[model samples]
Target: MIVTSYGKPAVVILSVEESERLKELDRRVLRLDEMDDAQLHEMIAAEIPPELRYRIEDIPETP
Candidate 1:
């Protein structure tokens, strides 16, 4: 799934092929503010082959 939040928030669910391609996106080294919880969830959900996904808020602020 592809999701982006620019205020109203956008969510796009992808097929297995697209999900595989989306896994290639690098997310470990990006700024927190660059993406919100929903976007992050979608990206990470695709990137990591997780059995279950979790939502974590309360991340520290960037300087």
Candidate 2:
């Protein structure tokens, strides 16, 4: 875990394996967002390897 100088919780640091897994999940989500519901459902049915997935909504949005 990363912390701020003021004794506040900041960003977290993940292990390399977990980080890579989440990165792959992020790529999948970005691609899935453009698809129709059925396609998304089919893809999900195909089973994406689940892992720790999270969104940092506090960050600025980017294309």
Candidate 3:
């Protein structure tokens, strides 16, 4: 939930599980942001190997 002050956002409230998940996502985004353009492109273009097929899972639903 969002808390507002004078028509502006002031604070956010999240469940413990939601907070932890957001923290992890933040960490991942930070790591990606640190990468250079070439590195980011390489990662984006990389193909998954057949050997790792068993590790793939369905995408998670957005909250």
Candidate 4:
């Protein structure tokens, strides 16, 4: 759960499984920082399911 104060996010509550997943993603992000752009994108795509993956051209950089 996300905790909000004064209409801004303050904290998050996560199950043990969710926390573990986030920790793993953090490690992946740290590793990604060392990869070249092409290799980084390839690894991200490979980890995500094909159907769930964003189309290269359809990805958004900003809200």
Candidate 5:
């Protein structure tokens, strides 16, 4: 359920189990954010096998 203020959702209500699951997910994201750049890159690369990766290049700015 959602509680609203000024027609905008202000708070959410969830079952105990759902709340616990969301809390765990939040903790996991926090841990990932704390990882160093190299560690994070390694983890991402490990998830996607070498066959599927592609390089991302910046596009030149258009005047």
Candidate 6:
């Protein structure tokens, strides 16, 4: 169950299996805000069953 600190107050209910799956994904996946585009693509490729390799692309710095 998830509780919100702000916005409309609500109660979230999850089955035991659903909760476990969500926790597993959270433990394995990096937060999008923490990843550059290349890193995000690499993670996606890695998750596929048949395995795909990707070259890392440099992120240009913002002026």
Candidate 6, superposed: residue stretches over 4 Å from native = 1-9, 31-63
Which regions of candidate 3 fall more than 4 Å away from where they truly are? 30-42, 46-63
- Tens-place lDDT per residue, model 2, 1-63, is 575667886778889999999999987674656899999788778853556444687568865
lDDT of 1 by residue, 1-63 (tens): 446797554988778887776676653457868888998897777754465545566455665
Clashes of each: 0, 0, 0, 0, 0, 0
> Which whole-number lDDT from 0 to 100 does residue 41 have in model 6?
87
- Cα lDDT over the full model 4: 0.82
Compared to the true structure, candidate 2 yields what TM-score? Answer: 0.46
What lDDT tens digits, residue by residue, belong to model 5 across residues 1-63?
889999999999999999999899987774776799998887877766667765665455555
lDDT of 3 by residue, 1-63 (tens): 989999999999999999999899987763777899998898899997987655335556565
**Candidate 5, superposed: residue stretches over 4 Å from native:** 30-38, 46-63
Q: Local distance difference test, per candidate?
A: 0.69, 0.76, 0.84, 0.82, 0.82, 0.76
Candidate 1 Cα deviation (angstroms), residue 47: 27
Query: What TM-score should be assigned to candidate 5?
Result: 0.46
**Colliding residue pairs in candidate 5:** none
Candidate numbers, best lDDT first, in rank order = 3, 4, 5, 6, 2, 1
lDDT of 5: 0.82
Q: TM-scores for all candidates?
A: 0.23, 0.46, 0.46, 0.46, 0.46, 0.38
